[model samples]
Target: MTFQSTTSGIWIPLITPFKAGELDESSLRRLVKHYSSIGLRGFVLAATTGEGQTLDDAELERLASVCADETSHCSCEMPIYLGVSGSDPRKVEKRFQQTKHWPIDGYLISGPNYLRPSQDGVKRHYEFLAGSTERPIMIYNIPYRTGVNVLNETMLELAALPNIVGLKDCCGSPEQSYDLLRCAPKDFSVLTGEDPFFYNAMVHGAKGAILTGAHVLAHVHLEICEDLHNGHQKLALEKWNRVVHIPRLLFVEPSPAPVKHWLWRQGLIDSPEVRLPMLPIGDSLAGKIDAAVNLQGGTDWRI
Candidate 1:
């Protein structure tokens, strides 16, 4: 199957909704409907924002299947991408091979987390993964998480690979992003995984954003990108202003926690449950998240 980038609008990295230490299929279904109704371009399951680290293989497969099932059930053909990454490049590539037959649209592979490979290593890592699978690959270069940055030249080199399609740029450096916009191939996508930079990224030629905030405000954030893309600069600016502070709040504690908190309040999930090594969000952070959710009017905020 040929997979093209759905290179515009809000692409929500879904949170794993759990119950009794098991995947909550019902809540998963509810979230699918909720986002689709609100006009999300697509859904990304089992990504960083989806709490992929805590899930088992059974759970991962179930998550992907449920998303595929729910999207079709709603008569919404939103594309679904699954996150595939790990510390070892070989292990990551093995996992990617495992998903070769899964019912997903694409793979969002982040750079190795702990090893912090050099630029040559980063390029070689992706080159290996890209060659291992025929699936379209979206490189996730989150230096904050990975401990190393995939620089522009390396990215352009990877972009030339036959299977490597684009990137989810969370380098947290606008300078790198600007350089990428100036240097990357026209077909190579440079979506901002950094929500705070979404508007600026769009203005500087980002294809779109794969944002954590999209879990809460999918429609508005997507519209912000779309408006900017379609030359509706004034309206895009207004929308951007409304959600500008969200990234800070969401990251105040750590990812998926604040996002899960918001989803819990909306009744989309059972608990704001995070696995060990990542405890439940603290009261202080929860309060701030609650305030933001309330401020945005409980997931029904007008874009």
Candidate 2:
């Protein structure tokens, strides 16, 4: 089946909702249903925002099934992309083979973590994956998390492969990100994974954003993308101003913790449970989030 391409617009790197140390299937369903009604274009499951590191294969499978099932009932097109990351090329390949047949449309894969391969090694790593599967793969160039930067030159080489579609760019350097956006192939996408970079990225010709903040304010995020897409820079910047201080609060602690806490407080999810090594937000951050939530009287905050 040919799934729709999610190369543009406000896509959510969805937060995995858990309750009492278990995957909350009901909340997962609710999230898909709710976000679909909003203007957000796509959903990325079990990724950085979804707490992919802590989940087991069984749970990952279940998460894909539930998200795909829920999205199936929506009137809008919400492509479900599963996240795959590892330090070893062979293991990542095996991992993709494990879940390739699941209900997801494609994979959001990161460069090898920790080992920090050279540009050549990164090139070969993605080359191997693109050759190993016909599934659409979005390169996740998050140098801070993955420890290796997939440079623009190497990325162009990988982008030549038919199945290696686009990128979730968190390369961390504004110069590098802008250069990639300017130099990337026409069919290749450069969607900023950094929520705070949305306006700037769009200004620099980024196709769109895959932001975690959209999980809380999809309408706000989507309006930003729409304005920019329609050449309404003033309106886009105005809408983006409302979110200038958001990423700081959302990422005050470790990610998804603060995002999960905000969702929990809004009653969108059952609990703000995060895995060990990834704790829930503390009182100070919680108080800040509460104040933000109180600003707009719910999840639709202007903060």
Query: Which one is best on TM-score?
Result: 2
lDDT of 1 by residue, 66-136 (tens): 88887886654588889888877778778877787778877898887788878998888888888788777
* Per-structure clash totals for the candidates: 0, 0
* Predicted candidate 2 versus true structure: per-residue lDDT over 1-303, tens digit per residue: 233256667789999988889999888887888888777878888899898989999999999999889888888878888899887778988987898789988889999989877899999988998888877889999888777899999999999988888899999999999999888888888899888887899899988889888878778877777787788999989888877897889988999999988888787888889998899899999999999888858853212
Candidate 1 regions with alpha-carbon error over 4 angstroms: 299-303
lDDT, residue 161, candidate 1: 85
Model 2: weakest 10-residue lDDT segment is 1-10
Q: Alpha carbon lDDT of residue 291, candidate 1?
A: 85
How displaced is residue 75 in candidate 1, in Å?
4.1
